[model samples]
Target: MKVHFIAIGGSAMHNLAIALHKKGFEVTGSDDVLFEPSASRLGKYGILPAQTGWLPEKITPQLDAVILGMHARVDNPELLKAQELGIKIYSYPDYIYEQSKDKNRVVIGGSHGKTTITSMILHALQQAGKNFDYLVGAQLEGFDTMVKLTQEAPVIIIEGDEYLASPIDRRPKFHIYKADVGVISGIAWDHINVFPTFDNYIDQFRIFAETIQPGGELIYSETDEVLKTMVDGLSVDVNKLPYSLPEYTIYNGITSVLYSGKSYPLQIFGQHNLLNMEAARLVCQNLGIGQADFYTYLQTFKGAARRLEVVGKNDNATIFKDFAHSPSKLTATIQAVKSQFPNRPLIACIELHTFSSLNKEFLDEYAGTMDAADEAIVFIDRKTFGQKKIEPYPAEVVKNAFANERLLFFNEPALLLNHLEQLNIANSNLLMMSSGNFGGINLIELKNILL
Candidate 1:
């Protein structure tokens, strides 16, 4: 197969390119600019474009298919050329669906925890020596590529993102998957620029559940009231399975699950993670994995990258970095750390990076999200407002929105780092949360200093 990729430097796009290349397809890709990892990895596979930027000549009639990335604009030169030539174009998710149509598809969808849950399923499948294709969102510990495809694997695990599939494809990525087994961890309104309202954002998941293949299973978080209501309203013929946080106990920062009269320790913690584990368990059970085997394999799962990842630790302190920009994610992460280390002073820092998190309208959703922390700090780079074409709001607005008297807001990274350095780190835990770097702060250096 001959395939051309526009905006190929994207995290998911590049992985897809590599996956197709490994499957013996002729993959060619271009991007206006290629960053570190993507650039090197693409070059390693000998598919990196000789020059940056879209070249109309690269889009030709000879190509069998064109895969578009969300990074590509609607008027992207190559995309226009492909359209002009009447070449078939597909969003990444659409193409993924086409590739996995014959296989049993398992899609994990929600505003949060999808990546972690998808990673858990993949990890257990690998541990149990199951052959399967997968398309998870993050770089996992044992997986070579985020996208994998093979003729032999009868199943495909997908991390179902609610984001738009491509610039031209307005459907949520999950809607295109038509999963045989679907899992919704929870629903919290996000992507304000797209959906605009909480109800509208939730309707996407409702549609996702409706899209599942007939007689398939829908596993969801029973503890999420919003999700529970949605599930109750569904009129589909698919079987419904609801899961909640399993019985677990935390002792001296270690969490263990009590199941079948046995205690199984986990490398990951928190009610959110425990809930994620249950969702993965149900999905795997549908895929023919036994309960005992799932728990046994889950013991070594260290979690997906940037989802409560431990960056540095020592006898005095432990530093964690999480990709948590949404209001619900922020609250869950803060509560998890505080619950685990109840005796330690918790210093939780978060960067207002994503469009939703930085928007003035969405700020109120974060009310008391960080209240569990002994000290809460919110950082917003002044330049991000200009980049996002948003009028910057005063720090006081952020303070009032959070409704926390102890919340500290910073517009400067250096000052935030300075304050962090001055803090008494002994017997304390630092949780850094952001979808983007804290104004390019050197977290590893800070972690070393704090430790």
Candidate 2:
């Protein structure tokens, strides 16, 4: 098959392009810009565009398919040419659903935990010698690409995201999958730019749950009250299997799940992570993997990239980096780090980088979310507000929104780094949480200076 991708430098789009190229398809792609990793990977595969901008000439009628990425605008020139040529053009996930329509899909969806749950399932399936294809969000250690497609795989595990499929197709990506066995970790309002209201954000998951194949199962977190309430009202025909926090214990900072007269030690920790493990366990069970085998395979699974990732560690100090700008994610990450090392002090710093996190209206949701941390710090680049066109608010206003008296705010990265450098993390744990790089603050340099 001859395929061309418009805006292929996207995280998901680039991975899919690579997967298809390795599958023996004739792959070509173009993008307006190419950043680190994506540009390097595409170039390594000899598929990176020779030029930077889109060209109508690349949209030839001979092309079998044009995969559209979210980064592509609706009026993209290549997209226009493809429409004129009457070639099949699809949103990335739409193309994925098209390819896997014949296979039973395990689509995991939620505001958070989807990537971890999907990673857990993929790891376990690989360990069991199960033949399966997968499309995950983050890069896993054992996987070559975030997406894997094969003609022979009977099942395709997907980390279903609730974000828009593309600029042209405003429908949520998961809505296109039409999952055979779906998973919803829980809902916490995110992507406020696309989903303007909390109700609007939640309704996307409702549509996801209702769209599952009639006989398939919808595994979800029963412990999330908001999610449970929503799931209870749904009238879908599929089996609605709800999961809760499993029996587990944390001893010496190691977490384990108890089942069938034995405890299975886990490399990962946290109540939220345990809940995610339960969700993964349920999905594996529905796929015919026994409970004992699931835990056994999960023992080796480290974690998804940037999800409570251990960046630096030593005898007295441990530093973690996590993608946790959202309120629930930030709270969960901080609680995880703090709870895991109860005896040690925790200094948790959060970067307000995303549109939602930078918005004044949404800042209120972060109230008391950082209470578990012994020292709470927030960093926001002063330039971000101007770029986002949001008026700069006083630090006191942010402090008031968080309702934390001891909270410290930094509008500059250097000042934040200076503050952190002065603090002795000798017997403490440091967690850096953000969806961004904390305004170009280097974690490696920070780790070197502190640890």
Candidate 3:
């Protein structure tokens, strides 16, 4: 089969193209801009466009299918051409569903901890020597591609993001999967730009729950009261499994899960992660994996990239990074590190990067989120506001919104880096959180200095 990709430079789009190419499909893709990893990887596969930018010629009817990325616009030349030719077009999630329609689909969905839970199941499955098609959000250690497609793999584990499927398709991506097994890690009002109100944001999860195939299973975190209420009165045909933090204790900075008073050491830590593990364990059980085997293999799971990832560390200090921009995520991450190293000073730094997080109204949601840290710092670029065509917010505005009188804010990268450099690293742990680079700060270089 042959497939053409429109706007293939996206992280997920390029990865899907690579997966299809590896599966022996003819893959051709075009994008106006292509960056490092995606560009290099596509070039290695000899599928990189000889020249970048959309080409009408590439969308001919001869192509078997056209997969559209969320980055592409409705007016994109190639997409318009494909539409003119009546070519079959599929959104990334739409195509994923098409590929796995015959197989059992396991979707991991929620506002928080979905990636970690999904990664955990993938790790466990890989370790148990199981062959399964999968699509996860992060670049995992053992998996080469974020997406893998195979005809023989009987099951597919998907990280079901609740974001819009495509420019033309407004439906949430997870809702399109129609999962045979579904998991809701937790509920938090996020993506305010799209959903606008808290109720609207929550309604998406409710829809996702209702979309589970008949007789399918839904595994959810009981810790989130909002989520609890959402799944409370679901139809009787759909099975519901609620999970919580398994009894575990941290000793000398190591977290171990306790089963029948026997402790099993874990490579990962934090109560949130432990809770995510419980959700993952339940999903694995549905996939025919036993409880003992799941725990046995999960002990070696390091975690997904940028989910409280330890980038650098030393005897006196450690530097970690995470993809946490939302209020719930920020609070959970800060609390996790503080609990993990109670004696050490915790420096919590975050960047107001996304459209919702940068909005003046959304700033107050962060109140008390960084309170657990010895020092709390927020960085945002005034230039970002200019680029986004939004009103510029002063440092004091952000400081006031957070309601932390001691909170420090920076509008420039250099100033932020300078402030961090001046702090004494003794007996401290640095937790950097953002979905964007902190105004182009080189984390690896920063880690070198801290370590």
Top candidate by TM-score: 1
> Who is ahead in TM-score, 1 or 2?
1
Worst 10 residues of 3 by lDDT: 229-238
Question: Model 3: clashing residue pairs?
Answer: none
Q: lDDT per residue, candidate 3, 172-249, as tens digits?
A: 999999999999998888888899999998889989988999999999998899989888966546899999888888
Candidate 1 lDDT over 42-78, as tens digits, reads: 9999999899989999999999999999999999999
Candidate 1 residue 4 C-alpha distance from true site, Å = 0.5
Q: Can you tell me which runs of candidate 2 are displaced by over 4 Å? A: none
- Using Cα atoms with residue i matched to residue i, what is each candidate's TM-score against the true structure? 0.99, 0.98, 0.98
| Residue 228 error, candidate 1, Å | 0.4
Q: What is the alpha-carbon lDDT of model 2 when measured against the actual structure?
A: 0.92
Cα RMSD for candidate 2? 1.1
Collision pairs in model 1: none
Go through the candidates in order and give the C-alpha RMSD of each one to the true structure: 0.8, 1.1, 1.0
Q: What value does the lDDT take at residue 154 in candidate 3?
A: 97
The whole-model C-alpha lDDT of candidate 3 against the native structure comes to 0.90
With candidate 3 superimposed using the best TM-score fit, by how many Å does residue 57's alpha carbon deviate from the native?
A: 1.1
